[model samples]
Target: MSDSDKAFFTRASELIELANKQNQNKEVKTGEISASFMYAVARYNAWFGSTSFETKEQMQTHKQEMMEYYVERYKEMLEANMNDYIEHFDHYRKTQK
Candidate 1:
């Protein structure tokens, strides 16, 4: 991984650890959100790094385009995951009751 990727991973890891910290008043949800954001940034950075660009402007444009394409896909994935989790939660609740 590149230095930029490493930085992103570090930030993401920090968020994950922060989420687990007992001292957090807002708690796990806050950390999870931050961690997710960091993960996306890291993914974006990695994506940008994977491509070749001759100019700074070209690289910037490419990054923007990639983000535009992937952000929607990421949202869809998250929604689907949330739906599955909700379904599982409902089942688990029923079983517990």
Candidate 2:
């Protein structure tokens, strides 16, 4: 991981925490930001990490491969999270009603 990757993720975490606080204050629950936040983190780690490539074409190729792998994992994790959230919400609603 590069400095940019660490810095971006740390900053993103802080911003998301602030956004959550704002949501709490507003009495809102969107349940839509976590996966997006993680996807950005994955993208930054894949694109911003230090890499030594001999040529422009090499760098481009590497980036494309990295994005492919990262994006696939992101999609899988996002779907899993969504499913977990749906199950949890269903349970909560059942108990509440």
Query: In model 1, what lDDT does residue 10 have?
Result: 100
TM-score computed on alpha carbons, candidate 2: 0.49
List candidate 1 segments past 4 Å from native.
1-50, 91-97
Q: Give the TM-score of each candidate.
A: 0.46, 0.49
Question: In model 2, what lDDT does residue 67 have?
Answer: 73
RMSD to native for every prediction?
7.9, 7.3
Candidate 1 lDDT over 9-70, as tens digits, reads: 89867865755563366654765666776787778676666577777778777777767767
- Where model 2 places Cα greater than 4 Å from the true spot, the runs are 1-18, 22-43, 49-55, 91-97
Candidate 2 residue-wise lDDT, 1-78, digit = tens:
999999988986888687676566545454545456566687668566435666667877687777787779779977
What lDDT does candidate 2 reach at residue 83? 88
- Scored by Cα lDDT, where does model 2 land? 0.71
